[model samples]
Target: MATTETAPRRPLDAGPPPLVADPAALRAVLDGPHAAVRDEVRDRLADQSAILDESADLTRAELRERVRDLVVEFGAQGHAALGFPPEVGGGGDIGASVAAFETLGYGDLSVLVKSGVQFGLFGGAVLQLGTRRHHDAYLADIVAGRLLGCFAMTETGHGSNVQELRTVARYDAGTDEIVVTTPDDSARKDYIGGAARDGELAVVFAQLEVAGERHGVHAVLVPIRADGEVLPGVRVEDCGAKIGLEGVDNGRLWFDDVRVPRGNLLDRFAEIGDDGAYRSSIDNPDRRFFTMLGTLVQGRVSVGGAGLSASKVALEIAVRYGLRRRQFEAGTPGEETLLLDYGMHQRRLLPLLARTYALSCAQQEVTRQLHEVFSQDTPDADERARRSLESRAAGTKAVLTWHASETIQECREACGGAGYLSANRFAALKADTDVFTTFEGDNHVLLQLVAKGLLTDYSSEFEDLDQFGMVRFVTGLAVETVIERTAAHQLFERIRDVLPGGRDGWDQEAGLLDPDYQLAMLRFREEHQLAGAARRLKAGVDAGTPSGQVFREVQDHVITAARSHVERLVLESFVARVRALPASPTRDVLTALSDLYALSTIEADRGWFLEHGRLSAPRSKAITREVSALLRRVRPVAGELVAAFGIPPEALGAHDLVGPPPADISG
Candidate 1:
């Protein structure tokens, strides 16, 4: 039902005019019908900004006072408890929690990460994986901020390699207790929030050893502090000054054979009996490990949401600055051009703007899927639930976290030199966001996990395809890949064949940009991923490698393939949304955004298309030209696009460039 459309004939000297769309229109596209939610988040952010402004130059004690003041406000309003269980004193909706937390992006990254450590990480781990007993015992105090909690998972030596952690929880049957200990300095829990100050309890993760057989990682409740003093056998040391998030007292925690009741274990998947015996509902150790890890996928989802917010803030600052900042004059005498008017500037920022939108849409989809699994029962079996959760968790976490890092850096650069200044927020945001890539599992490692999941799915779903079916799928894939590689060449060739083009022919060719072509290009990328995976797997097989090593190699290929597939899917979703819109200036703006996304992807991976003989040299050139042109068109809408993310001034704090008028300077 779908087919590629070629550009129409055109005259030599004419091309499509540059795009222009206002900030308000861009905001409408991002907020959609969820304007009220955006507004609420904006108001909260504004309040936070006010606090930052008030304490801009305070002492360490004064700063802590300000942080405590803000924490009190956040605690009193129950804003920090958005994503917890309703039964355990939470909002009961993961989506709502993420949405509200994202607004925190407009404020300080330090505040956002600190708050995330409290609610999303510490509180979330317990609520998602712990039983009702654990919930009743600890969730209320955590939610109310009466007892701050820290998530102790990452050790000094083992970061992404969580399965190899050295921290141990050996059950002591004589005392009906579990002896939790740090075997060496490398085994100490490093970089734990709330551990340095404020936290009374910790959700400690360690190797579960019962009856002498070691099980995989599991979580347990360990009290590290009470009555404003450190508990016996626990050593907490400040992490000291860092790049950013100074307000958070992130620190290292060492447990010196601390003993707690065996019941302290938060066992939803794996448990310890009264006699110090270990039992698990899961049979497969690997599956059980993933099941436990998947329970905490909310951290990734929240990070994604937070990343989007960070990108949005950076864009807002850049766009606002771009609109007001002037540079060399062009087109009109003595009138300096807006920074956004420069093609190079647009090239740097507009495509990223489109990407932010794509990321936002993808984030919402991930959040929605998470809510479905957590809140409602699906028709599939329990194993299916586990697999689905694992896949989504891996995919979303990989995509969103990477996007956040990339987008923030791009935004920082886009703001020219001002972006690097601490006063501008970019530098601070960059510092705080740097650890996101490493935390909640490293980006590359998470992507490999997604890859493994994809391979498993592919083997399960398509391993039995008949020869004819296999042939058809491969043929379809190859054809799509060829088309993508040659799209620019194909467009230019078709146009030149019909009408010897100058600017007019180029303009007509540009009109050939349609939803069907976009869809086809997307399909081509997906096929390329599959083909690449197949090639890698075949290479490994031909080398006579061990099955496990070969499988790992195959997994890396599959994850890269899966990531490409998901990226295309996201672009297609953005294009679909654009097509569904009524014809307007806003629609035109969205169209440019969609094009930027698609073309940039194609540009990034032109090699595959070229090697596969999908495109000719002329077509490749055309793609580059078209991409540059689209960037130029989207430049005018850059400010509007970021503004659509809907962050409020207060949450951004004193660092925000756009804030309310000072009381002393009355209008």
Candidate 2:
């Protein structure tokens, strides 16, 4: 149980760059714009994290008990229903709900996900897809930790394809009840968290049938367990151990003629009438299904936000270690250089730090949109905004989670052997979050969702998004590299730069800082590639290919287009945030980090820009050079930037782990 307490072998490195590394200052940056909610949750977790941290030695049963205790604690604080309506025993502050969910990642990932499944998925379904009847009856208990439940949506055969799940809920006209059944093994709910032990009820999703009419996928609450016993006709099996999140008791469930009151149907969008007929507010089944699932978008955003938190925590640990872990002498003989002083180490971790900061900013925007979309009545909500929020949620979940995976792995490597040790936190952080790329929804599938939104006249879909506003604002800019052709804009600038000199429309420093420039390039990439992909898809269809085949032909392009949209979202969000900070020297450092995030992302994707003539070769080269320069500019503030993450000192681990007791030689 003893952790390696690494101690500093020598004095600390010379003063870091001027950006504040004060825990409070760095924490302020990590907390983003909503400091109050973010800090409240963060400080709460920091105070009570011991109870939440899962150790390697705990058995599955032990972990489950620990998780249960944490759930009780969360419920006691009313966090279980923070996003639910105040009328339904919740605070109705969706933003605070999301903040609390994301903040839990600073402790244990298992606990983080368990909280998500219980509150975000289970409670959210009742609150979002159900009417007054379900809420008035179950909301208080669910929020009070008196009714632990599972969200049984995914099946062995339909992990991502919810529409095709074979689980059936047939109306029994004579009894005025609904009978839920799994046709076979493939239809059993797979990976149902809380099912193995704690869950007593479930929000079961199945294809509902009334009068032989099939309703796509609908959720209905079914009693699965009572008095600590599995209900009749309900079978549950533990998923057992996993590579990580052992503290979460994941399991599978099967039902055989599980009957519930017909009112069990969460009939917010659709319902069955007493006359044995099916009815719905929305006529189209596809749209109705999407509308139902759309209410659960906060889960995806929460997962993505959790991923960011994990990354921030990992970076804080590694970068803090790197600042103190000394290696072979470089400039001064016998005076070892700090790990962070090495450019190689800086390259390994700093950009990731910058990227995490960018994602934090983007997540803030997504969380805000989530609050705005769900805090009010559905009918009065903006359809455009809803779609935009879904797109952002999908894109952010896909991109940010992937970023977390990459950042965590890089952080481990940057810390060398110390990162691999259990005590140091890297192993736990990486193992627990390794599933992030596939969490909530598979990254590829999520990206495809965003792509579908873009191909469906994205200009209109994104018109309400800030990215579009930035695009319009950038119509005229002090762009760098004028007279050089990239595309339409370049040609226009070329005409204006007649017989060029320094007077040409090139201002490298100013251009990189321009919000107009960053957003325009990002939007241009998104629009152009989407248009190309659409053309390819249309041509494939015209050639008499199956719709699925046509989609497959341009799948990669579809993913690329989605990536562009997400990158634009991140860049726009970061810039807007940086620009909003009060004027100060620290603000300048943040602005530099924002610029680094933009330029580095652009540099990574420059080949696409060059291929599409969006960025001429020279301009593309300029982006790389600028990115390198920003890396150096950011180096001095690297410690401060990561310090801003505000990971507790204990989690940061020791600078030089006390070497394991010198070889027990001379036994």
Candidate 3:
């Protein structure tokens, strides 16, 4: 049999270099390789036309109304119970629940989040952490939406620190009851969804004391109200009016010696026996705490998906506005230039577009990992399961929430004064998303958790090394750090010596710009952060401090390192994605996008480079010039880039038609 020979696959070509590079030089690299992952995402998006369209037109008020309707509809249809076990009328696939839930992000973040709270948060907590008995008795009503519930873990005093919460659940063995009380004003469960008016049940988190031994934090099912009346000893207070998400009715709850049956305790992870004895499958207190927390990782994953959706919306709005809105018209009378034609505008927006793209890829990876762990087919080891969940939760949560905030703000600025208008959507989107940074674990605190995980990994590696091996490892790290710092300093100095002054200087240096310089600079920052952390750890050891406190201090440094690492990874991913595209008129535009992303990152962290002697003043100037140049080069393709987001016209809805075409010159 004769075998057919095939041509080698070529990467997608990004079109012409922005005014900065020689067209010949640009053409040479046009046939570079493409990432299969991008194609998969593109194809996935292609199949979801209707969902994307609905996502685009979704507004805050409409979202609120529709969400309320969904709550009622799901309740009536019993659709809310889809993710639970078969015995309790659920599909028994938690991964499917998350997958379907993530798709809702394409609709509107507010709607997705509210739905998440109803199904994933409120209903999910009861299903996963609650016992089979609890599921049979209370899960049905909660899932059907007959009873709205809230996951009450956060308090005014202790936000990310769940263990420090003051809500107490003292078991009264004589009465066969537990008194759940919020001891002080700060201890009240604050900012709980469904607490204000809708919720009839709450998975209240509080310190559990069985036979006088405090058992850290545990979940208990509490009846908050019946028939619109607050239950005895339960106080419900509305957290009225906020910067954003006003429709969801977030509120505070105070428990004053609230008497709940001992059986109401959702003790799947940590149990309290009928005889007032506390027992747990997890021996380590810390492990138990994390395992319980990990069960709720779905919220973080959903938040990430939501954040990515929001970023897409913002980018679409800004890019559309850029293509339509006119600015300086040089020679033609009454003929305004498209906002995107301006180099500055591209500089401001395109990299954020790149970031949104990168974040989407990361979110998909996180979702996949989450699905794997939750999948029944996979052999689940307890430790590996916890790490997988925690890693996805912490990493994606930090990345996506931060991306939402930054991208929204950038999109707002991209649209200029119009972006400030409420009707334009930027301002409202920003306000609504602002809370995302703190919710589902504050970004800083979440980063700290990520940092702790890294330290643990590092410590484990440290344990395997002998004394000489340890010394060699430290030496290798130091050498790499020194070499990176030196190389950066030299490159920056060389660029400064060659490049001219002012805008003209920037234009010339732009041609000489190498993307690798930025990557190198970032690497230096990572090394610096790592070295600083090591120094701190050493100091703590010398002081003979408690291991736990020492670990916490080291963890803070690790968070800084992790952030740097994440940023670097994003830049690398963006470049890799760009390199994989097929050659077309749009290829050069994509390359410019890659450049814009890399340079913007460097520009954003100019201080790091400057502080570590990685970048000289001249090279920094070149970075600004090159980024602006790339932005201008990619301007004409902004529409195509947003279009490639593959959002359906329905999701874009009226917003898709709100603006005129870029080529429409009737002024």
- Stretches of candidate 1 above 4 Å error? 1-29, 32-35, 51-65, 331-333, 377-389, 458-512, 546-559, 579-585, 650-667
TM-score of each: 0.84, 0.88, 0.77
- Per-residue lDDT, model 1, residue 577, is 66
lDDT of 3 by residue, 1-667 (tens): 3222211222224433333223232323221122222233234334433432343366634544555665555455544455677786776655455555544454444545666788888887887688778888877776666667788889999987787789999999989898999999999999998788677888999999888888888889899989978899999888867787665757899999999998888887888786778889877665577667777787888777677777877887888877777777757998888777776677678888866766655665566567667654422354555575576477678888898898889888877777776655665578778888887888877776554444344343332332223333433354445335435445544554444353244334433334454455565576567666656655665677655576565666667876876676666655554545554444445455566767787788888778877567887887777667666656555666666654544444335323644453211
lDDT of each: 0.69, 0.76, 0.66
> After superposing candidate 2, which stretches have Cα over 4 Å from the reference?
1-26, 51-54, 458-503, 507-510, 614-621, 650-667
lDDT over C-alpha atoms for residue 232 of model 3: 91
Which whole-number lDDT from 0 to 100 does residue 515 have in model 1? 46
Error of 1 at 214 (Å): 1.8
**Per-residue error at 466 for model 1, in Å?**
29
**Deviation in angstroms for 200 in model 1?**
1.2
Model 3, stretches more than 4 Å misplaced? Answer: 1-66, 74-103, 106-109, 376-385, 458-524, 540-558, 572-595, 610-626, 646-657, 660-667
lDDT of 1 by residue, 413-482 (tens): 7677777766777766777777777767777776665544443443333322322232323333443453
Best by lDDT: 2
- Return the candidate ranking by lDDT, descending: 2, 1, 3
